[model samples]
Target chain A: SQTIHQWPATLVQPVGSPLSLECTVEGTSNPNLYWYRQAAGRGLQLLFYSVGIGQISSEVPQNLSASRPQDRQFILSSKKLLLSDSGFYLCATSTGTGGGQTEAFFGQGTRLTVV
Target chain B: AQSVTQLDSQVPVFEEAPVELRCNYSSSVSVYLFWYVQYPNQGLQLLLKYLSGSTLVESINGFEAEFNKSQTSFHLRKPSVHISDTAEYFCAVSDDGGFKTIFGAGTRLFVKA
Candidate 1:
């Protein structure tokens, strides 16, 4: 079974502090990984997506960046945490074969609270 | 570019009542549609998807969605809902061969007793 594991399930960071959230996938190789930030009423915002090692795609200009150093490891980071950066962060993985991508499998998510 | 729009923001229904959540999408290329359910404080889970072939797809949990290409819509329906069904539902769309998947604003379904 494919599984996504994200760490720091909940975090309380002070403004201007640095941030790092890690996610790892098991039971699958070369899967597409994504980072999403969900704010109240705004739905899941696609922050970044990575299809392979050292490749990252930023969906929107924001205070965050993503990196895929390994095939199954994806990380979300920020140099400085802004108050507006507080939200639930989710990590998901999906496998694609010839035609299209499959449904995503998500981690428990990290709830970041920038104080 | 592709985008998704879930027509309803919230829907309140009693247990065992039928419900339909509307979704519409826009894409310049052939697309794939999906519905995901997120329980409170939990990550989202895939409920169903429409890739090709049949326009209608059903989940193991009795939820069904029909993809209407002409209307650019994929509406989810269930004959009856239970209290356990209360959750936020998101409609998503992605272009064929694209890695970026866009999600709708979401519809919160409140199944009351």
Candidate 2:
């Protein structure tokens, strides 16, 4: 069975502070990893997705960035957090088949609040 | 550009009542459609998907969606809904050849007792 782990489960940070959210997938190798943000009443917004290590595709221009250091490890980072950055962050993985038919599995998610 | 539109922002239903959430997509090429459910303050979970072969697909939780190629719609429905089924439902589409999945604004299913 494949599982995804994300942390810290909840976070409170001051504005203009640096932020790093980690996610890792187990029981799968070379899977497609993604970073998403969920705002209150808004739909899931794609932040970044990586098909392999050192390869990332950003869906929107924003204050956040993502990196794939390993096949199963993806990190979302921000140099300085903004008030708009506060939201529920999610890490997801899908089979690397590239057909878009495979289901995407999600982690429990991290609640980040910027004050 | 390929896009998905969830017709209703919220659907309120009494427990054990039937419900339907509409979705439509626009894509010039072949499309793969999916429905995902998100509990309050949680990540979205895959409810069902439509690739090929069968136009109708079902999930273990009694939710079903039928892919309508001609109409460019993939509407999710359930014969009866429970209070546990209250959640946000999202419709998404991926070009059969593309890796990125575009999501709709989402519909909130509020099941009342």
DockQ of each: 0.62, 0.63
lDDT of 1 by residue, A1-115 (tens): 8988999999999999999999999999998999999999999999999888998989899899999999999999999999999999999987675345668889999999999
DockQ of 1: 0.62
TM-score against truth, every candidate: 0.97, 0.96
Question: What TM-score does chain B alone reach in each candidate, compared with the true chain B?
Answer: 0.98, 0.98
Which segments of model 1 are wrong by more than 4 Å?
Answer: A97-99
Interface RMSD of each: 1.7, 1.7
Question: For this target, which candidate reaches the highest lDDT against the unseen true structure?
Answer: 1
What does the lDDT come to for candidate 2? Answer: 0.91
Q: What does candidate 1's lDDT look like per residue over B63-102, in tens digits?
A: 9999999999999999999999999999998777677778
Clashes of each: 0, 0
